[model samples]
Target: MANSTAKKNILNKIKQALDTPVPLPFELNNEAVNVFQPAKEELEIIFAEAFTKLQGKFIFCADENELHAQLQLLISSKEWMKIFCNEDQWNVLYSNTLNLESCDAAITGCEYLVARTGTIVMSAAQQSGRTVSVYAPIHICIAFTNQLVYDIKDALQFFKEKYIAIPSLITFASGPSRTADIEKTLVTGVHGPKEVYLFLVDKTA
Candidate 1:
C-alpha cells in the first residue's frame, strides 16, 4: 500500500508538471520563443566546433575494432609518450611508461557524451581507471554518435533504468579543470585535465 501510494504521488506530480505552462513576460502578449533544432550534420559540426572552442579535440574511428586499434595507437603515440599505463589492464595497455610529472592528460571510453550541455559522462570501473581521465593535462574520450543524448537527466535516467549499476564515481566533465587557486590569477590543468577531446565514431555499423 505504501509503495502504491508513493507511485501514485509521483504520477500526480508528473501530471501537474505537464499541465503547468512556463511563465512568460508581460512585455508582449502571446510572444513566443523559437527553438531551432539542429540537423544531424549540423549538430555534428556544431558539437565539433564547440568542443574545439573549449580546448577539446577528437579522433574519429570506424568501429569498435577500429576503436581498439586506434586506442593502441594513441596509447603508444609519440605525441603522449610521457604518460604511463598498465598493459595488463583491459583498457590500459601501456602502464610502463607513465611520467607522473610530465603526465598531463587522460584517455577513456564513455557510455555517452551528453550533447545538450556538452558534457561527457565517464563511470569508474576496473578498466576505466579514474586516473586515466583525471590525472593529466588533457583528456581524450571516444563514443559513437548514436550514444549522444540531450541532457544529464536523460543520461541518469538511462543509467538508472537500464545500466542498473550506479557508478562509484560519475563525473560530468564539460571542459578542462581550472581554478583561481593562487591569489587572483586564473590557472588551468592544476586539478585535472585542461584539454578534452571527444571522438564520435559515426562509421560504426
Candidate 2:
C-alpha cells in the first residue's frame, strides 16, 4: 500500500510539472552573429593562400584557351600518360580520351569553392560522382570564379536554394588526405589522393 501511494505521488508530481512548464533560464537571441573578422583580401587570393598552406596546388586561368594550355603543359611536364576523366563535357573541353583503369590522374568539376576554408564542395549529383575525387592518386578540380563563396554558411545556403532535395552525398575536401593515426606520426594520402590540384578559371575575366 505504501509503495503504491509513493508511485501515485511521483506520477502526480510529474503531471503537475508537465502542466506548469518552466521558462528558459536565459532569453534566446535569434540574430545571426559574426564570430570572425571580415576578410580584407579578394576571395580568390584568400582561397589561393589558404589552399596552398594546406598543400594544395592552385592555378588560375584567364580563359578556356589558357586553361587548355596550362593543362597540356602540366600533363607534359608530369608525363601522366592516362588522365582519368569520365565526364563527357570535361573530356570534350580538354580533348582527353580517358581510360579509368590505367589513368595516372583524375580531373573533375566541383560544385563550389569555399574561400575562407579553401575547401572544394562536391556532390554525387555530378557526373564525376564520389569515387572520381578520392579513388585516384592525384585529384584535379576544375572550378570557375563565380562558384566561389565566402563562408560555409553561404555554401549551405546556396545548396539549399539550388536543389529542391539535397544530393545523397555531399563532401568538402580541403586538401590531400592526411592523418596521424599510427604512432602519432603525420601521414598523407593513406586513405585518399596524395596530391590535390585546384584549377580556378576566371569566367568574369
Candidate 3:
C-alpha cells in the first residue's frame, strides 16, 4: 500500500511538472558565431595537410586522365588485383578494370570533403552506399574540387539545401579507423579499413 502511494505521488509530481513547464535558464542566441579562424591557405591545401596528418594518403589530379593513370599506377605498385567499385559512372570510366567477388580495395564517391577537419561526408543516397567505404581493407575516395567545403557547418548547410528530406544515414570518415582502447595502445584498422586514400580531381583547373 505504501509503495503504491509513493508511485502515485511520483506520477502526480511528473504530471504537475509537465503542466508547469519551466523556460530555459538562459536566453538562446540565434546569431551565427564563428568558432574558428578563417583558413589562410586554399581549401585543397588545408584538406591535404590535415588529411595526411591523420595518416591518409592524398593524391591531387589535374583531370580524369591523371586520376586514371594514378589509379592504375597505385594498383600496379600495390599489386591490388581485385578492385571493387559499383557506381555506374565510375564503372564506365574504368571499363573492364573493376570486377571481383572479393576486393582488395573499394572506391567510392563522397558527398562533401570538409577542409577544416579533413573529413569525408557520405550518405546513404550515394550509389556506393555505406558498406563500400567501411568493408574494404583499403578504401579509396574519388572527389572533385567543387565538392570541397570549408567546414562541417558548410557541409551541413549544403545538405540542407540539396535534400528536402535528409538521408537516413550520414557518416563522417576522418581517416583509417583506429582505436586506443586496449591497454591504451593505439591500433589501426580494427573496425574498418587499414588504409584510406583520397584522389582529389581538380575540376576547376
Worst 10 residues of 2 by lDDT: 93-102
lDDT of 3 by residue, 1-205 (tens): 9999999999999999999999989888755866788889999999999999889999999998999999989988998877888887686654244443368888889999999989999999998887889988999999999999989999999999999999889999999999999999999899999999999999895
Q: Which stretches of candidate 1 lie above 4 Å from their native place?
A: 1-43, 62-78, 85-105, 181-185
Best by TM-score: 2
Candidate lDDT (C-alpha), each: 0.66, 0.89, 0.90
Superposed on all Cα atoms, model 3 deviates from the true structure by an RMSD in Å of 3.0
Rank by lDDT, highest first. 3, 2, 1
TM-score of candidate 2 relative to the true fold: 0.87
Model 1 scores worst on lDDT over the 10 consecutive residues at 85-94
Q: Each model's TM-score, in the order given?
A: 0.61, 0.87, 0.84
The TM-score-based order of candidates, best leading, equals 2, 3, 1
Error of 1 at 93 (Å): 5.6
Clash totals, every prediction: 12, 0, 0
TM-score of 1: 0.61
Compared with the true structure, the alpha-carbon lDDT of candidate 1 equals 0.66
* Residue runs of model 2 more than 4 Å from their true location after superposition: 1-17, 20-22, 29-31, 93-101
